[model samples]
Target: MSDTPLLDQLESGPWPSFVKDLKRVAARKPAAKDLLKQLDRSYKDKITHWKHGGIVGVLGYGSGIIGRYSDLPDEFPGVEHFHTIRVNQPSGWFYTTQALRDLCDIWDRHGSSILNVHGSTGDMIFLGTTTDELEPTFAELTAKGWDLGGSGSAMRTPSCCVGKARCEYSCYDTMDFCYEMTQEFQFDMHRPSFPYKFKIKCSGCPNDCVAAVARADLSVIGVWKDDIRIDQAAVAAYHAGEIKPRGGGSPYAKLDVKADVTDLCPTACMSFDGKKLAIDNKNCNHCMHCISLMPQALRVGTDTGATLLLGSHAPILEGAQMSWVIVPFTEMEPPYDNIKELIANIHEWWSENGKNRERVGELMLRLGMRNFFKSVGLEPPSQTVRTPRANPFFFWHAEDFEAEAAGRKYIKI
Candidate 1:
């Protein structure tokens, strides 16, 4: 009974998809039914009827509503006043089953029973609500310990991986840090007073389980300053029990390290004799690949900290960019004022000079790193390495060069 034969096949897959759920909802809800019909029409015509609603928000709030409107209002009256609500997610996305059920119940009562678990900015996306219900819905949700996430030009929800709580590889408390930041920046999160939406994401370690390094405006990645802890006995046990050689003449067999942990080190910082393994602490990048392979044999270093990367974003005005190392290391401890100061400085600088709707990464691209560093009052460190450094020429400030020439050391901030 549907023209979308190929789209229907998507419902038959082993995994459950939102499409199937939407279709099911469509069977009961008139708005959902119209939405499906409109979507189908849009697909066939290669166009959409939805348009952005200018300056839409809840009472006393200037951000957090992406307005959805149907141009074919007469044909799809049910979808005429549809809007999306982005609710800030809990740190590490850890929600009790009861909490989720309660949230679903709330949405079912106030709006269409459609939801997106996590939006691109790490918010719990509640789809399909009218303008009239917005304030009441927000009030009820706030009463129940829920808050709206950021939209337009404001600090978005800070997301993090489940560190220390579950993963042994975690070098820091990512969830706690994320929660701290969310609470501390409440004013910034609720207000739309920035050049563009800013996102912060935390990873337990450089494994980047949440893809923070590639997508976040500011990325906090856990790291260690000292050598990885290794248990020689456990290493030997693992080697004896799990390490095996491929008998057949396979290409991979020739290059396999077998149980030798030294050969598995991508940086070649490790060396193994017949009985023991030695690692060059200075050379280890803390990739955790070797540790992942032999978890029982090795652990993270004692002096744990975080590496801050900046200016990562998806394709927009300037294009997609992977965040670059800004602060190579910062001690992540209680009352993280240093990180807060750094965030404030970055935001202030960007808000002053950035164009409307321009992301931090785009501004960085437009204005060189040197200018950004100067504005933020940070000296370019030796560790700073930009991607695609094809043309090796770099501009040095005359004052800095003179100071260096005079044998006066420039202190890094």
Candidate 2:
């Protein structure tokens, strides 16, 4: 009989199955075998039998190693304390062969040997390990120059896309910035002292491969504020179909220079007269549509920088929100003092006003952005909102209106 009859059903499908991998792990790790049994019971019962215990880690850190112990420990003794071990991955998830080998070797020695490529928040996740094994496992990884990611109410591990390493469109060195950010905020990452978790993600350009705008609390995306540099000859090549649109990835049957490039522009600022191309640079929104289609012809402005957006989060307290512009554009020079100051100010404000378990975004929502902007010393721009709220909401206190007008005709409430 199959150990996991229900789980084996998943294997029959065309896609590869984790159940198959679990069975493989079960062969060597007793914990995995029992885990399968517990899962079978879970399928039959339709209820969770796992409970969060006093999980701990090696680095004298109290968080990051997340686990839920089996409630039916007597029945599934081998899988009693399967904790998740989160390793702080390198920027862009780039790892050499030796590094991967080392991690696999450590997992084989002390863990269930099941691992995730990376988690949504950007940590390289080891799926199964005992609480006692965490210390030894992390010790070996650290010796090989790796560390733990964040969890609980602290800042989560920061991440960045592969910028200069491979991407030609990179406006800044995203990996370096992300690395420095990780280092600068080490204390926050290790210590669980925030009202809620915080995430920071960087993208080399507005391509946003890291989904920074939608996923990060603090989204740093590369941008250019000046004119789009245009090369006439390259533009002619693209217009003539001599150069394929994004190397032949367009949905259009034939590359229609007008339909694909000029007309589709959000600002409608591009014009091509067959052999000649013209762009109204001042009207350009830097949407990257044209630049992406004709990379050789249209290049990002020389005055490259990054845009700062804040308060974006997944649906939990508030609905899923994309980041809004905080700073429209700023040169992200090394020793990034501009960003450092803003972050310090934000943290200081949030630490004082944020409620227990409330996200910084929720805090801003509660207090209202006007007051929040005043407290943080930020100039709220039109770019802050896609469109001005038709119905504006505010939180006015007793002192917001004059004491003399309390009973008068002027109604502040």
Candidate 3:
């Protein structure tokens, strides 16, 4: 039935794989069949038939569609004008069964049946559509309360964890914040006016369920400033094995307080007293390990806000980066102007100075973090710490050295 024996063997596994599903689809869909043939040919020849078609998109929108063309158009006629459509997903990726069915019904009518639930940037990626189908497809989707996500040099879709709705460790309402931002920054999402793509991701707590600090250009992580609230009776119960942990595990059965929580603390701020556990809140870094281990005994502090981390991105020019602390804490109330203004300022600075195709993190690395702060009119806070380094590579500034030579106090910038 198939010429590609090795490719066919990939379908033998018990677990469902995309390759198997593609083969199944190929049996019924001409496009899929051609696609499989082309794939086999490419594997045999050690090459591909895909090529980029420069800058094709729907009317009024400058981004979102990634144009792809097949070189073997005669052989793969159905895939000749294949294009990708990015559908903006709801915050936390929560969807009802009816909503999913509705989305599938709309897509089934428009283009190829292939779909990617959450692409790299967390958008609902619809694969393989044609240029002629773009407008009508977009219109129908919009009529059904769906819209295109961002691409190219625009702000991509914002993602978040199901905060207060599902996670007990959530410090703030991440889902609501994500929705609010998506609605507010509609223009930024649809328009391409930046040096490169910008992305935002929010995590409910420092557990960082969504990996926001490592992935997003701008990251908002929920945090607590005050002391962790301790239920002394619950702490006693946990120690005595009278109750279970939050997720139905035997309480303190496998817990080694010295190894798990206290030793693991970055600042060594936790200590278990004879009667109850106590934490040195001053030294606590707001790492969520203790809260995760003892959910019943510990809850987040009342003074909750979001920490803003800036310039995180996957490697392109510089390297993979974890976001640096920009604003350590900012109130995240409804009508989040404080957060919006900060983002706007960062965008303005990056747009004015960034080179073509350079990410925000790469720009910061090239221009120096000091210049970035000064350009954006932000004072460097004491909380700003460098990413962990294995090697020491520190250099004193010329001005600071000059001041030191002159026997005056060299105040660092």
Give each model's whole-structure lDDT.
0.82, 0.83, 0.83
Per-model TM-score, in order, reads 0.90, 0.90, 0.90
- lDDT, candidate 3, 1-413, per-residue tens: 66566567667888777778877776756666667777777887789888875677888887678898889999888788789899999888998998888888777777777789989788899888788888888898888888889988899989998898998778789999998888877898898899999999999889999999999999899998888999988777766666565546544464555566677888888887656688999999888878887788889898998898988887765578899898888888988877887788889999999999888888988998788887877778767756556438766778877888888785456
Could you tell me which 10 consecutive residues in candidate 1 have the lowest summed lDDT? 247-256
Superior by lDDT: candidate 1 or candidate 2: 2
Error of 3 at 44 (Å): 3.0
Q: For residues 93-144, what per-residue lDDT tens digits would candidate 2 score against the true structure?
A: 8999989999999999989888898999899888777878888888898899
lDDT of 3 at 183: 85
Root mean square deviation (Cα) for candidate 2: 4.4
Give model 1's TM-score versus the native structure: 0.90
Candidate 2 wrong stretches, greater than 4 Å: 249-253, 388-413
Error of 3 at 168 (Å): 2.5
